[model samples]
Target: MSSNKTNALSRRAFLRNSSLAGGGMIIGFNLLNSCKPKVVAEPTIDLASLDYNDFNAFIKIAENGAVTIFSPNPEIGQGVKTSMPMIIAEELDVAWKDVYVEQGILDTENYTRQVAGGSQSIRHGWDALRETGAKAKHMLVSAAAARWGVDPSECSVSEGVITNAAGETLGYGDVVNEAALLEVPEKVELKKPRDYKIMGKNAGNVDIDKITTGKPLFGLDYKTDGMVYAAVVRPPSFGHKLVSFDDSEARNMPGVIDVVTIGEKVRSLLAEDPSFSSKISSSDKVVVIAKTTWQAFKAKDAIKATWEEETPMESTEQHNKILTDLLDGSKFNTMRSDGNIKKAFAEADQVLERTYESPFLPHNCMEPMNFYANVTSEKVHLVGPIQTPAWKAGLVAKMLGREEKDILLEMTRMGGGFGRRLYGDFVIEAAEISQTINKPVKVVYTREDDMEDGIYRMAIKYRIKAGIKDGKVTAYHLKEAAVNDNMYGLIPNFFPAGAIENYQVDVASYKSNITTGAWRAPYTNFLAFAEQSFFDELAEMMEVDKIQLRLDLLDKVKPEDDERIQYSPDRMKEVIKMAVEKSGWGTKPSNVYQGFVNYYCHNTHVAEVADVEIENGSPVVKKITCVVDCGIVVNPLGAMNQIEGGVIDGVGHSMFGELAFEDGKPTANNFDRYRLIRMKEAPVVETYLMENEYSPTGLGEPTLPPAGGAVANALKAATGNRLYVQPFTKTPELLKVPEKEIIG
Candidate 1:
């Protein structure tokens, strides 16, 4: 079991008489013991009584001038919880401090595309959010103008205060009631980029107070009266079957409420259901319910079950060998082929080929997998941290033979998602357990359970061969082999696709029983390192500058033909130049080893420079300078946090993150075996955002793919050894070392 000081419900030693949100409430959290929420009484805004006029779906204004903005996307520490609302508040011309942001539930009529994956929260919602806020502001201004009998355009608004040419001022709260009666304009003129005051400015994270003060915000901290705790035990191995289980000892344990086997229950419910994701394969599982969390866990440990292996007990050794064979063989599908690869390669001056390997990785979310479900015959209320609430609501309804309308899902702030909660199998387990026992159940997975039975990043191998002739690139061929599934999505149109005339991508995959899905930046995470490192090698082989070589290659792509390619060469060039100028690229100190990487992914262009030095025979990254062109940044502080987090996460994972499997089971189950980058190991990162009039793109995952590649390239410059494999510590010499002495 994990004990998060902020997220763990079991560790809550004291109760807080906080405020409650929605209806006549103040729109916040109530972390009290009672089933009824506690509210805070304020001076300016009455906590007991307040009348709010609903201007629209996204905005609500109180009589005392407090505005509530509903955040529609899941906040997975991706800054969407804060930035998404900033957009709405900006067009509404409200002060950032006066706004109270509330997490909206799954309402399909008011929201579409509520999932948090793909780093598309801000990108996809840009138009709708601006329109929503702009439309509301238009209505409010029209109301003020109608009272004065003046033209709406003549009345300018600032900081939620409208002032006419005659010097008459009216606060938004004064005319909110009249504004609610006016017809909302379908299309209101959005504020010009030059006039935006909220965007391109530093705004603090909205949940910073709750997070730093150890308040109840995450899914793990949610609790209510009459709620029972549950501990579940899944199959020990992948593709295993539950033959029988002995739960007599568990049912007799202290505080044990009930023991239910899920073999026939879940399978029969989802056997014919197409909505079932079937990723977790939880049908062959068992559940233990009890009065307390510790008691439930104790009883769960006492239970034992018999399992039959229905599939091969796969191993990492076998997977590596299979991937190698597949890469060498010819059974592959051509995803993208631009020019004649054979002719260019046959006429090249030199041919180089090297294979890069990566291991499976687990999400290892800090809070672990948990959910609260009250599955009654009439209504099913689910509260938890999930990225795809709408999609999972449908699946849960189908599994319980209920309608989607009967299921209500409330999203809590997630400790970390990184595409793990995108699959809500744990959420479904809570619903299943609650339906069986006819009680409100909150299921919590132990650290070992979360690590062992994890949906891992697919172990993949890539063989990239490039043909060079006369100091110019002639052909490029990339062959990939992965476990379970091949590459899908827009990776085919990524950078160098249009730059390289003779480009071909071939891929082959082997189906494995182990669950594998998106991890961080998905396929681009490791691919960035592999390809960027290869390009550095090519630059060295051709006696060309590393940064100059990329610019030269992009010179072949026209900046105007932006629609033909997924990434713009102009944007890529801008970030590269900015990184070079800011990092003092060519003018570094003689002792500093610098490596440069430029990448385009997630619809954003980013560049990174890693400064490294060998200390005690180990590579110590001193600092990293990052340049990003995600267009107009909504919140600079939040964007910086996202970039720094992504960089550190990328560097840490690349240096010492990997999951090994033996006999179809994880070899490492907890912190005792798994290695994570620590604070002392993290390097200082400086971020610079590209200023532009274009709308904001994604900063969550786009900046991650290049961090490791830059670090790896820097290590190559210092150690003269190119680290091809992930968890670079796998190298015998890259072991633990003492900290370097700091000169004050």
Candidate 2:
């Protein structure tokens, strides 16, 4: 039997009271227990007698010691499907050749949180799955050793066989029955880094063969019995409810099932908590569900639903007006205050003031929000791409007024999440539709519906002032206007909470005509962009290197001495020192222009030095040198790929991504007008991960925030012009300003 001990984790020491470790090291919302989960009396399965008849999901095993593993995470070109299995196989102690790989069932039991976003799959799955395989292997070894009347240590396991010192061997399949009868071990010994056979080694994605051969994998490629397509017609404006709809034309369309009106309605008569802000109703609705996606789309165009417009101007104009008003408003909550700010500003030799603005963005995952639900009076089955299946299944059961056990959630491989799939708004929508129709239905949102209806990364404006004395920086004041409540309402006190002296972060709300929700890095995605860029400008005025200025400021704000510091100054210095050394900070080619940015969030530290060159006044990033310390490196290759992808994604958003509105309707719906960074835009990234074996920090979002400002700073360096806006499509020539004459 595998040793049942809780404190024997070999990979890394489990933090007894770590907050992120509470939910079993959340990886893309999967709660993988550091200890093996107690298996409460499961039905026995005889491995030797078991037959592989059907090719379902992605894995299958035979009695002859052939094993197949499946890729559960959707392969949107990120190599998660292959890397995740390496962790499982390492502890299973099976030969790579004997293992067969398969994808997971679109159900919650087979795969918990199967959504691939936030770069969490590998980090979250590392410990839990290794324990699972170790437990299974221990059972097999115990069964064989007991039958041989030999000590378990005397029998070594290799390639699915247990061999004694005398060379007598028995295949794992021979003892499957006895192993199955044993209790599921609570704890199992995990392999150390030195002994890891597959984790650190290079194993390409398991689905590479299938993807190259054009095998059906994605939900777009998924088909079902009597399955029909579906499309929804949502309001053109945000918060729009259907007052009236005439579906006569829709009823006559070809392949039409039925035209249904989906608008906001009271889900429950229960009272909402007046003080609670993080509550989400399971049955919230303001949607349209129809038969075929094409038919629904066509019917939506034909059926005229009366909409009540919220505002007169567009979202951008309204947000800007709100920001301008906030600069004069007094709803400012004093996040932090050190000495007297009024006295500091009055005593300064000169006061420098600047306003920074960042726009709202969309979390455009490759797969549009979709869920397949088969609901009946007996039970409800849900299958689709979702980040948090356990949580989503609870809400789905609540919506259907059934037991939580009745709601079976199957997770399909997501095309991409980037934090979009975590909310599970689409899954609930699909379940409600299935309950209404009393049939197996899959609700699919068109790219337009998905973009326009979904929540957004809130837009923000920052007004900053710094005291400059004799060409030296002294005190700083930052006042911000936040359009939404905290993006991640759970962590309201993230940035500017207790960090920064004389800080006043006023969050003002001007209810917009658009819905807003979590984007990739939540609020930090934009806040870091704005704050890091402003710091760069401040450095230029002080005539000190930007990296040095930040380091000095960080050193002055000690964690113990000052409570207003959000990031650890020591950690920030570590990355900066490493990046500067590796990138040849002071020395560079005459043609290469480099910009530097470093920041910390999500329990991780990252620094980026992006190099660029201006050709014909357009910016072209050549290479990115990144330094990251995320505690531990789970899978070096997987972690590096996430950094590369995140950096590229951030660059794409800063350079050419935005959603424009006309009246209350969205303009950038499809890829034709909404641009994306392709293979050509991807920069060559050289990442250096800190080798200290601390518990892993977040890898998904750390590299993202710095990418935008680094590019912006590099552009300014090449042309001597500061570009202050989202999307460089605006003429770079407009940013040129002649240097002012200095008074002696």
Scored against the true structure, residue 578 in model 2 reaches a CA lDDT of 98
Model 2 lowest lDDT segment of ten = 1-10
Task: For residue 226, give model 2's deviation from the true position in Å.
Answer: 2.8
TM-score versus the correct structure, for each prediction: 0.91, 0.82
The Cα local distance difference test for each model comes to 0.80, 0.63
Best by lDDT: 1
Best by the TM-score measure: 1
Instruction: Tell me each candidate's RMSD, in Å, in order.
Output: 7.1, 8.1
**Residues 669-712 of candidate 1: C-alpha lDDT, one tens digit per residue:** 99999999999999999999998888788889988889989998
* Cand. 2 TM to true fold: 0.82
Indicate the worst ten consecutive residues by lDDT in candidate 1. Answer: 9-18
